[model samples]
Target: MRVLSIIVLLLTTGLTSCWPTSVSFNDTGSLHACLKHFQMDPLENSAPNAPINYPIELTEAIKSGIQNNTRLLLSGENTKPQVTITGKITNYVVSPIALQEGDNAAQNRLTVSATMDIYFDCPNDNYTHEMKVVSTRFADYNSSQDISSIESQLLSEINTQIVQDVINQILSNW
Candidate 1:
């Protein structure tokens, strides 16, 4: 019995010592720590005759999204050259997606597209890349549901999707 107990204790110690191996992936924090600063510029409204004129709120949402993201740290006070992201809301269109009767629209889809320029300031060199992101949401013309409420929800979703895309683009390099 003493021999068995000793063997079990040795085996348990060996197993525990070999557990929890250090595993590191490409998304480690140390890898991203160098490019920590993320400066967001004012989002430009380039859409001529846009359906909605909520540029301030839209811009604020994008800024908040980038600041709140875990991958990148917001650099509002830094005056040095950092990662600057400039965006332009190019299109906001609501079109008929389906028809119920003759010339009657049953479903409508709202699509929002934005252009982003990601400028990276490295120690050796600086470069910029352009990425276009889009998001779409649909609404059904039902009498039971309020049209304005449906549109408001769709718009909110569109903004979120676009912001998520921007974050993905920023993180894709790492």
Candidate 2:
């Protein structure tokens, strides 16, 4: 009985001492911070297509995109901006290349393309400004990978980059 009790104590000690050795994310957390900084509350997930408008509509979009992401939901929260920027992801590009992978796998080169509309609404200024910024990035993923999963991941990663870039732009121009 004493040996059994000792074994139980040791087992419990080991179990309680265990923890996740690591936490990982590609860009979700940073993206979330950007969203929260912009003061977006995410709506339930559905088709990416949501109603859009000239300026304020873009605002909702920036909010929606950030809100939908798990990382952004945690980090990207701030009071709604007096002047905000928003845009839609109109075009996405996926092309093949002969780039070498770490394991020398024949895979396609990943690239992301999107058009962004930036909003500048300042009550102090007499003019409300809207501008478009186009952004792109190359995502390195195994070429010999599943199309759907790679595409989804590439888009998410680039979207996070885009959101970060756009937020930086807004901050600078302000």
Candidate 3:
């Protein structure tokens, strides 16, 4: 009985004294802080049917969206790991969707397609991801309604969708 008690005590001591040295902490936690130091390059407009020569709509939207997204903190200029986002608007289309009584267009759809590459200057092995994002908007128009205003509104809607897509892509990479 004394030998049996000594064996039990020895077994418990041996089990408790061994600390696993194989476990290691993840270093990816710093990546989130690094994401705050972001920089956006001007988006290139390469669409053949693009009405404007510059991509102000697309560029401004993405910058604003990233700055406003809660998951990220925008750092104007910092020494941390830098995040660079570059992209181009590959497609832009405005087409009539609905016809009026006289065969005139009553409603139209606007679509914008873009591709973006996100690069992180961090130590992580996976630091870059290419994302293709698209947005579409529909508007009802007639002779009385202002065409420019409608177009602007449609563009705004498309920008909103694009921003959401960009945010989703970045979050999913994590």
TM-scores, one per candidate: 0.70, 0.46, 0.64
Among the numbered candidates, top TM-score falls to 1
**Local accuracy by lDDT, each model:** 0.66, 0.51, 0.68
Query: Candidate 3 residues 3-76, lDDT tens each?
Result: 99999999999997896757756334324544556777888888887768437877888878977763454555
Q: Give me the runs in candidate 2 sitting further than 4 Å from their true place.
A: 1-81, 84-86, 99-105, 124-127
lDDT of 2 by residue, 1-174 (tens): 999999999999898789677777665432222233333333222223322321243345456654554233322344445334434445344566665756455656555445666554445545465656666665766666876676656656665676666555544444
User: Which pairs, if any, clash in model 1?
Assistant: none
Better of 1 and 3 by TM-score: 1
Candidates sorted by lDDT, best first: 3, 1, 2
Q: After superposing candidate 1 on the true structure, give the runs of residues whose Cα lies further than 4 Å from its correct spot.
A: 1-19, 23-31, 51-53, 124-149
Q: lDDT of model 3 at residue 6?
A: 100
